[model samples]
Structure formats: C-alpha cells, structure tokens
Target chain A: SAVISQKPSRDICQRGTSLTIQCQVDSQVTMMFWYRQQPGQSLTLIATANQGSEATYESGFVIDKFPISRPNLTFSTLTVSNMSPEDSSIYLCSVDTPPAGVYNEQFFGPGTRLTVL
Target chain B: GIQVEQSPPDLILQEGANSTLRCNFSDSVNNLQWFHQNPWGQLINLFYIPSGTKQNGRLSATTVATERYSLLYISSSQTTDSGVYFCAPTPKAAGNKLTFGGGTRVLVKP
Candidate 1:
C-alpha cells in the first residue's frame, strides 16, 4: 500500500480565488490521479497526472479550470482555478499501486476540503 | 466509459450486525476495488478484488469479472464503521482511469 498525503486539510477561500493542492506519495508511482467529491455527490475523476507529461483530464473537467502539474514521480499538484461556490468540494489525490502479482490497488490521500464563499 | 452502480443507497445497522454492499458495472472490468470513506472524508482502501474473493478482518469482498458485479461484506459492525462505501472499476479498454459508483452510506448505531 502507498501512503499519500495532501496539504491544507481544510480551507475556506473567497470566490474568484484559486487554491493549489499538493499531493505527495511515499513511493514513486507511474500514475497519480486527482478527484473531486462534491456535496451529496460521488467521487469524480478530474485528471490523470503522469510524470513529465500533460495530465489527461476527464470529460467534464478541463486544464484551464483545473490545471495539473506533475514535476516528478512522487509529487504532483492540482490547482482549482477561479473558485466558486459550486466548486466547493473535497479534492483527493491517489496513486496507482505497483502491480503485486494480480492485485493493483489505488491508494488515496487524506483529501483537502475546500469551502468557497 | 463504464457505468457503476451501488445498491441500498443508505443503510442503517445496529452495532454487531452484519451487512452486504453490492456494486454492479455495465461492462467487464480488469480492476475492481472497494473503499470506505470515514465521516472525516478520508478514503480507506478495503479491497482490490478484480476477480475472486478476499477477506481482511471484518470485511470481505468478492468480484465476479464475468458477471460484472462485486459484493462487499462487513461483519460485527461497529459505530466506527459508519460512513460511505464506494466501489470503483477500471474497464479493460480504459487506461488507468477508474469509474466510481455512487456509494452506499452506512450508519451504525450503538
């Protein structure tokens, strides 16, 4: 299992501001993902961050609104640009564990709870 | 894109009771995992059963790849188990992206 941690466990931000969340993993991984869990909603994949490459975002998300940076194998950052009340949600970072035999699990970070007002 | 669904959107169980959570997918997947989200919104990986069954302490999970469904069992439930449970599956054709289910909210009473 991989240990992942996110900064700013909880934060309150004013509308129109941006928040950059940092994700750090204990071990090097090939794939790191960003996710958003909105109020009363399921977790949605925001993007897939690969080292030395541009992150592949999902259908409803874009690089402009949610820009991502993957500087290395063990670290990445997700910046939620132009925050709004609707953008308030818990952001999480996860790493795809190296395949151990037949099992490869994705471990999640503690998550950053952002409240925009 | 594969669609995932979890049954019994909300469940109320007393301490020491046992319960089952189900996750059904629209297509065959190469990876399936169960996760528990505590009240504080921390996601804890429970199992990574793509196919077959596996158990760990009070929780067990079974995933039938052919059937495109999985089941999670929690026994001797405690108040600490009160939280939301989610299942995510990655389709064979979908690279590393995982599609998550809506999740089942469990409330354990003392």
Candidate 2:
C-alpha cells in the first residue's frame, strides 16, 4: 500500500472559474485515476492518468472540460475547466497495484471538496 | 456499461449488531473492491476479493464471481462503523476502470 496526499483539502470557487487538484503518491504505482463524487452520490470514474501520455476520459467526460496530466508514475493533476455550479463535488485520486503490491486493492486520497457558487 | 444494484439503500443498526450488504453486478469482472467512506469522506479499502472469501477484524466479504454478485458482512458493529460503504467493480473487458455501486449508507447507533 502507498500513502497518498492531495492539496488544498477544499476550496470555494465561483462559477466559470477553474480548479487544479494535485495527487501525489508515496511510491510508484501502475495505475492512477481521478473520480468525481457529486453531493449525496456515489463515485464516478472521470479518467485514467497515463504516465507519459494524455488521459483516457470516460463517456460524458471530455479532455477539454476536465484535462488530466500525468508526467510521471507518482504524480498527476486534474483540472476542472470552465467550471460551473454543476461542477461542485469532491474530486478524488486513487492508486492501484503499487510496484510492490500483493492484494492489488485500490487506495484513495482524502479528496478535494469543491463548492461552486 | 455495467449495472450494479445494492440492496437496502439505508441501514440503521444498534451497537454490536450484525448486518449484511449485497452488491449485484451485470458482467464478469477482473476485480471487485469494497470501500468505507468515513464521515470526513476518506475512502478506506475493506476488501479486494474478486472471488472467494476474506476477513479482517469483524468485517468480512464474499464474492461469487460466476454469479456476478458479492456480500459484505459486518459483525458486532460499532459506532465508528457509521459511514457509506461502496463496492466498485473493474470489468474484465474494461481493464482497470472502476464502476461503482449506488452504495449502502449505514448508521450505527449506541
């Protein structure tokens, strides 16, 4: 298992503004992902951050609206672009199968709580 | 897309009670994970059993891969166990992407 951390535990933003959330893992992992959890809702996969390439976004999500960058194995950033009140949600980062993983359970960061007004 | 159904949308339990939560998925998956999201919203991994049974402390989980369903058992529940429990399955065809269930919200009473 690896220790993970996220920046600015939470934030309050105006509609049409953007927020960039950073995810840092303690060790190198084979997979890194971003998830969105709207208020009173379950988690939804936003994208998969590739180590050296552009992210793979899920349906209903686009690169322009939620651009992701993974420059290496242990760090990735997801920016919610041109945000709106609908973008208010908790953004989470998760890692799976660290280099030395055995059980292969995915672990999550504390998450960044965003409020759009 | 995989359809996941979780039963008993909400749960209320007395201290030291037992409970069972079920998650039914629509397709074959390479992995199924159980997570507990605390009041602070930090998700704690409970199990990674794609099949078979595994136990930790008073919590245990069983996944019947062939049937595309799983069960989570919590015995002698405590107040700290109050939180949202989610089951996320990674489809074999979709690789590592996790599709989550609607979740079972549990509240443990003293």
Instruction: Highest TM-score: give the candidate number.
Output: 2
- Which stretches in model 2 have alpha-carbon errors above 4 Å? A100-103
- Which candidate achieves the best lDDT against the true structure? 2
Instruction: Quote the positional error of residue B26 for candidate 2 in Å.
Output: 0.6
lDDT score at residue A88, model 2, on the 0-100 scale: 94
Reference-based TM-score of each model: 0.96, 0.97
Fraction of true contacts retained by every candidate, in order, equals 0.77, 0.77
RMSD of each: 1.5, 1.5
- Lowest summed-lDDT stretch of 10 residues in model 2 chain B? B89-98
DockQ of each: 0.67, 0.65
Taking the tens digit of each residue's C-alpha lDDT, what string does model 2 give over A46-114? 999988888999899999999999999999999999989999999999998655443367899999999
In Å, candidate 2's interface RMSD is: 2.6
